[model samples]
Target: MYKISICVISFVFLFFLSVSLFTFSMNFLLNELTYFIEWEVVTLNSSSIVMTFLFDWISLMFMSFVLLISSLVIYYSKEYMAEDYNINRFIMLVLMFIMSMMLLIISPNLISILLGWDGLGLVSYCLVIYFQNVKSYNAGMLTALSNRIGDVALLLAIAWMLNYGGWNFIFYLELMKNDFDMMVIGALVMLAAMTKSAQIPFSSWLPAAMAAPTPVSALVHSSTLVTAGVYLLIRFNCLLENTWLGQFLLLFSGLTMFMAGLGANYEFDLKKIIALSTLSQLGLMMSILSMGFYKLAFFHLLTHALFKALLFMCAGAIIHNMKNSQDIRNMGNLVLQMPLTASCLNLANLALCGMPFLAGFYSKDLILEIVSLSYLNMFSFFLYFFSTGLTVCYSLRLVYYLMTGDFNSSSFMPLNDEGFVMLKGMMGLVIMAIIGGSILSWLIFPVPDMICLPSELKLLTLFVCLLGGISGYLISNVSLMFENKALNYYSMSNFIGTMWFLPIISTLGVINYPLKSGMMILKSFDQGWSEYFGGQMLYNSLKMNSSYNQLFQNNNLKIYLMSFIFWLIILTSLLII
Candidate 1:
């Protein structure tokens, strides 16, 4: 039954891969092929509601990658989760997540996209809480509610789309590009994407969501869920071009990249550091998309999915061997014990850092070069290069703790790379991580252009890469001699490690005061005043009146008739007066 899940997912992945390859070849040889299936559900007062699925090269390509990674994750889970009692449930939840991502990819209609968008949120919540622990529960809640903001934003977008007499937003994008109503819709959609992508203010949930199983993290954080927002923006690129909202997104996303990169450097948890790396990549994708480079953004998104998934798989292998100790500080000299996993880790890390001729080089380096060519302000330029450097910084830091430094864990701790099932999954992505970028860049961007830029500027990416490597190497070794000095900066360390207190602000700041106020209102009104005035007091008074009436009714009928007549006389006198 455990292996059956992997087989089913593999078949699904193969089917999608075949379709995607055929579509890509066809599109390359001919023109772009976009297939749309629509069913009219109803028409009311000249307005219509329809379900639409638009499958293009972009959607098919992304769907293929998503299914591919999911299959690998499922296979990897065979070893990582072998002893789990609820492995099937976890596999099913993962499949559900992949299906949601596929739905999000294919749907062009705003209303139809909601099905996938909400599905991703709900299924992610399920995945995050799969462990059935308090930490998982809280992380799941945070993940679900944080994404709910985007869900609401999307709903608002659908409402705004009503101005076009239909929910098919793609059809009206061009017509409404300059319209005020369209701008509003675009802003709402951008906000929705920002939340899903974990940009800036909504950034905390990505790392917090690492409470899920490692396989789930590989699929969700690395490739599928976090990239959904970038995909959304890629689809809506036309609507956002030259808009102030787009510029605002560029600014915030740059900050997000910087913030996440900085946070990862100070973080100790292995999964969290990877999670923050994913966050930083997401910011990179969002910032590029905000700059109207949809194709480049999509290109980076694809290459990133390949390498980042591999990275997580390696992290999973390490964590599994470490007996679930996620603190990287406890890991060192692992290359001696787990050569295969260490090789995979270093390879993926290099790809992530944009090493020359690797997967990230073709896309990430190009993106950096493009950013440099543009007229960026001081802040934006600093954000870009510093974030780039930080990528290398953290990657080196991670390597030092995991592979290069002295063996720091218990000498007898059992750890090895004999999990061939896990190795198989990682090896599949390793091939892609090595060659995915070059192939994708050539296929996506066939025509090469000449840049009339200075040699220094052309080599800036390499320079930053070298600088980051040097900085990381120095910081890693220097910290051993200055342990107390490192500890002395407790306040600053907390701020950076906590992601500039963004998590506190997103969780406690956003919800605590309001929740406390709600509790107070419940105490004062529902429990106190409403109970006294509307329930207990009214019931007691009615009971007393009923008792008095019962006592009076015990008298004789003649006395009652006399009393009624006297009361009637008094009423008549009062009415006359």
Candidate 2:
């Protein structure tokens, strides 16, 4: 036992050290390689297949964001899983996950991208089921199965591109530059991305994934698995431009955002609420990306990683201290007990709610600005507005419920702060949530001529934040509306929280009609053939032999003779014919 414990500890330490080293190496290479390479392309086959390594603005920015978030999640997980008996297994899976994400981000070919993409899905299944409980096992199965469907779509898209466009394994530029059927490939890829990103119908798997531990949730939500779909869409942006598929994606993203935001507001479980919020935020990011604001989407992804990871880590701390109770109603006045955690939580909450000068303000405000300028129709505008309001409501509700409520006896415990390793991990994320925007704006985007915002829009956003915070607090503390509701009405909230199912039902309806008709036609043909040719039952009886059955039952010598004779007669008949 002692030896096993030592091995686990050493393995975990080495795993994290390796991730850090890889991150450092990537950063160094980014600097040195930029000086040597301007543009280079190498053809791999006669079919116009090629690979290009050009460090463009968009790719570099996304690559840096993914690497940074991945490293931080690793740091958080090291401490978050410190006490688990299977710490070594967890660390191994996390390292593998990071490797896959890194490969996907920097991959220059669709083949390499698919390799990393499928790798992420596989590792995520293992991580989700690390506990080996029945619930975790079921959740893992569901997530894996749903992701496989998406993978099939993506593979089909790739095959379509290679066959029709005569392009294979090349960079996205070459794929887009080809004069192929963009609409067909775009629709297929968009469908694949929607499922992977948990948009609308596919969003069910994300909340189910809350059966995993909080650290896993943070990694999946903020940095690794869920972002794969967004990456795919961004990579194929040119193909998607000026297509009906792009419009459908925009509409689907808007609906997902609205539903997920409402669900987040109604849920009381800390992790579930965060999971739903992650879905909503991902939807908002996708919506902006579809609008040609790729930079804005990338910025939101970065800020969200910082704040969402901080919030999840803090929630983990709270849950750990409370002996694993995840119910928000059971928690109150925790700020008095764990000041360090409360402070970090508050900072993250403020950032998520888009408080002025915070990281979320810069990213989310950019998205809103883009929406305003995009000339969307009324339906799109209404959906975006409602989702924004719900985002504010749920983010503030989490803040108030976790940090400041009436002191509940059930929520109190004789607990000390978590270790330095945990706090340090969370503090790094908190700092990013504070200053990430300024760094990205000044160094990355370098848009000094463009003003940050109009004074009117800035005031409106700030006012919305203040109003949401105040309203959420009042509803939680002063109002009797929720308390007085009947059991049936309370169940209605649960139904609303599961609204991701609506899209699933719609998708099923769309698929089932043709499927059912095809099955009926096949059945009719089978029946007609049976009536005309004595059916499968009669055919089976004609081939049956009493001797053969006896041989199977008793291993008798007579059976072998009969079998040989039957084969000889059949061979003779064939020769005569």
Candidate 3:
């Protein structure tokens, strides 16, 4: 046991070290790879293929977040899963997930990209059901099934692209210039991304996935599985450039952001509240990315990873101290007991709410600026604005619920802080959440000219941050005054909570209603046809034919052989004809 523990520890440290090195050397790696410039060597069947260096500014930005979040989540979970029965299996799955995500980030072809995508989905199922509970099992199954539907769509799109575009490889740089069936392929890819990212109509699986441990939720939701879709879409931004499909993606993303934010506000379970908020933030990120602001989207993805993981880990620490109860209403005055955890939580929440000077402020405000700059249509701008408001509301509610309520002494377990390993992981992410945006802007973009935000836009961003935080505070305070009974009157909120059923019912109605009516008409036609054909007589002949039964009896071998020969001859004649 001791040896196994040491080996696992050593492996984790090595993996994290490699990731950090990779992130720092990303530009050099891309430059070196690009210098070689051999696109002809790699071929699919007889088709010539172009393989470009994928470690571009955008890919490197996402890779940094992926490595940072994934490493921290793994580190935190080492202590988080200390007492679990299947610790080795858990660690194995985590490593595989990280490796697959790395491969996904650097993939140069569509087939290779799908390989990583599917691998992440596969391991996600294992992590989700690691607890081996009925709920976890069911949630994992649903998530897998939903993701498989998206995978099928993706595969179909790949086939369609190959057939129409005559491009056997799905290299973004090559496919960018191709015009044939780009719309169809783009729409299918969007559908695939929507499901993977847990956008509306497919978002329930994520909330259900809260059955997993906090670290798994933090890793999968914050950095890996959900982000894959955004990464895919952004990696192929040229395909989405100036298209109606792009507009559709932007609108859908806006709708998901608003709906998910509302859901997060209504939720009380600690992990789930955070889960839904992550979904909302991802939705906002998708909206930004879909609008052709790849840099802004990458920035938001970076900030969101740091803060969301920190938030989940902090919530996990709280849950650990509270004897595994995740109900925030049952939590209060925790700031007084768990100062370190509370401080981290507050920092993360501040970033999430887009308070000025925090990482989220820089990234999210950039997205808001892009939305304001959008001259495409009024509907897109209004949707983005409304969604941004809800984002503020829910983020504020999360902090208020955990920290400000009256103390519930009954819910408090002995004040036990998380292990040093876990705290170390959370603290690292907290620091990143504070400084990531500035560092990224300095490292990746061209000096002063590449800084996308104008001075006026920068000031507008600060103003929006201030306005959002103040409004969120006011709403949180007012919300405390309402009794739990007041919630019952909010019919719209109830409908939204049960909104998963809406799509299911609509689908069944579309499929079943017409089929039922058609079946009734078909039954009538069948009855009429049977009457015309002496159906009763035929039925009676089959039912009471002693000769027919005798013909099939074991004692009547010659008769059976003759009947088989006649049928074979008829089938052969039909085939020949």
TM-score of each: 0.88, 0.78, 0.80
Query: Per model, how many backbone clashes are there?
Result: 0, 0, 0
Q: List the residue pairs that clash in candidate 3.
A: none
lDDT of each: 0.87, 0.73, 0.74
Q: Is candidate 2 or candidate 3 better by TM-score?
A: 3
Question: Which parts of model 1 are misplaced by more than 4 Å?
Answer: 1-30, 40-49, 480-488, 518-577
The 10-residue segment of model 3 with minimum total lDDT is 29-38
Q: Write the per-residue lDDT of candidate 2 for residues 70-91, one digit (tens) a residue.
A: 5555566666676787776776
lDDT, candidate 2, at 68: 57
How many times do residue backbones clash in model 3? 0
Worst 10 residues of 2 by lDDT: 33-42
Model 3, residue 406: C-alpha shift (Å): 2.9
Question: How much does candidate 3 score in TM-score?
Answer: 0.80
Tens digit of per-residue lDDT, candidate 1, span 444-506:
887864556689988888888889888888877886666557657667778888999988998
**What lDDT is obtained when candidate 3 is compared to the true structure?**
0.74
Ranking by lDDT: 1, 3, 2
| C-alpha positional error of residue 89 in candidate 2 after TM-score superposition, expressed in Å | 1.6
